[model samples]
Target: MLNRIASFALATLLLITLSACDDSNPAAPEEPVELDTQTVEDLPADPTVTVGENGRPQGLNQYTFFSLRDNEIVLESGTEARADSNSTAWDIALQGTTIRINGGTSGPGNGAAYVAEAAFENVVEVDTERLQPDTEEALAIPTGSGNGWYNYNANGQNYVRPIPGRTLVVRTADGDGYAKIRIQSYYEGAPELPADRQAHPSRYYTFDYVVRTDGTPSFE
Candidate 1:
């Protein structure tokens, strides 16, 4: 009996020691998602119906009104445009990416953090009616005032730089569809603004984004 009890105690200690030494590895972190980006060009300075170099009134990238005045891209609705006598021809604005309906009175709001995508394809489709405004997933666009929206890099060259890989996703104001956007630049031709010329007539917003018409989460 004594011998059997001693053997059982020894086995119990060995089992405890083995269990304490078992170190399971922790889980791996999730990979970041990649979103598709779209680009628009020569977005006019306002809804003045300026004859773009392409000789066309600015088409609403799915918007009823757009303007690049007051150092801000003011996105108003058609009714607001008509009521205020503003042009209802512009679509997207650069200060990051903002959109409003034909009659909306405000620009995109600071609602929520934009959710990045896993993978998306770039396109030239500016269908706003199908795109939804996501309030929770919006980001502020970079402007050319003060610190503006970009960081100045002095390491390689004194150049105005953009926040790399920063983006936003928004649901349409009506809550029907979705759109993803990212600011590419605040200057003409998406050129890097010179550090010496910080106030060089900003409000010229260049960006890439995708609009989803199917109301699904997939923006690819």
Candidate 2:
């Protein structure tokens, strides 16, 4: 009728001008995910043990009993090696990378106060014995008795050796015999050593200790 109502209002104004045309060609804002970083030449220049961020193992790792705070070091036995582990009075606390000989005591000789509960095991065995848990007849550790039974400077006897990729086990409550020595000497980036039946481990960066005949002490 009036030209079909002006052609149906011009087809509803061209379908509302193509639905307010921006026809969606402007949707490009999504690009921000680039995180991949590791530089110390990408780590492991000479690493053998690394576990940092306080899960308690840093730099060089090995532990049996560790109680730490900062960068502490206390290797006791008449002390004089200190990084301040409370200036220990030799109650046997080999601070971090663990070794703690603490458990029970009543009283006896050869300076009593090391009675029971200090077990450790690694195991291989080749028959060896030496004791002085206070004395009886379980001898032969006299390889040059600085007062044998492991002539002390704190149990390791001033580097007759062990610590190259170390594994040490020592105990002598007398005839509870244990000594599998190593560590010709050490310090300065060392780790990864095996194929040692004694050669030139004399010292370059030694931190080696070998004591096979793995386990002992079970008074039950």
Candidate 3:
């Protein structure tokens, strides 16, 4: 009888010890890491881009050329220019007259297109993971006007232009992913202000973009 009682006491103590251990060793909560696509000192941040800045970090100088091809961003300075392939030749291109994405047969998978948003500042998150090809919101922007992608106004003193304030949500070519682009400038390496047209040589584009290559629509 004493042995039986002692066994029961020990069992009860074991149960209590187990309970204490459970309470002391709770599971750790996971904290999600946020991703940003902004260029750092003219380079990409991480998991945000396979290719970082395609142009100079200080900014693209006049006539500099850049391209996004095969998941790599290439930048070079000089008078070299790329002819339009009209086929996803290059995923995207920047020149004096236009900022364009590949479309039609030249595009990847289904081809790439974009829809303009009110502004980049209004964007909080991109639903990239679930994005699909030929989304209804996409539009094939044209390179008609030399100022086709942006406009500038001198509010008496400063030259105001649409850049980060003008955002494009894109369905990338090959139907692989989604990217958000904010065109910062179209004149010589993306200068902040629009100087006198005669004073600034236009055509070079400086921009920022975040791409989600996972076929998802999330940019964050």
Residue 196, model 3: Cα distance from true site in angstroms:
3.8
Residue 30 in model 2: shift from native, Å? 56
**1-220: candidate 1 lDDT, tens digit per residue:** 9999999999999998787767444467886345444566535433323366788645333333332112223443222444322343323333222333322334332222233322223322333343332233332222342232355543556454555544445544334445666656655556666444444433355656565545555554
TM-score of 2: 0.21
Ranking by TM-score: 3, 1, 2
TM-scores for all candidates: the values are 0.41, 0.21, 0.56
Q: What tens digits encode model 3's per-residue C-alpha lDDT throughout 1-220?
A: 9999999999999999999999999999976545456531222211111233675223232222223324444433333453433345345544333444555533343445444545765554654443333333543544342233455553554343553454666666556656676766555445666567545444445566666666655554
lDDT of 3 at 95: 35
Supply candidate 1's per-residue lDDT for 84: 29
Local error of candidate 3 at 118, Å?
4.1
Model 1: lDDT of residue 28: 71
Residue-level lDDT of model 2, residues 22-107, one tens digit each, is: 56556688864332211111111122335778875343422112112111222422334434333322222331222232222301
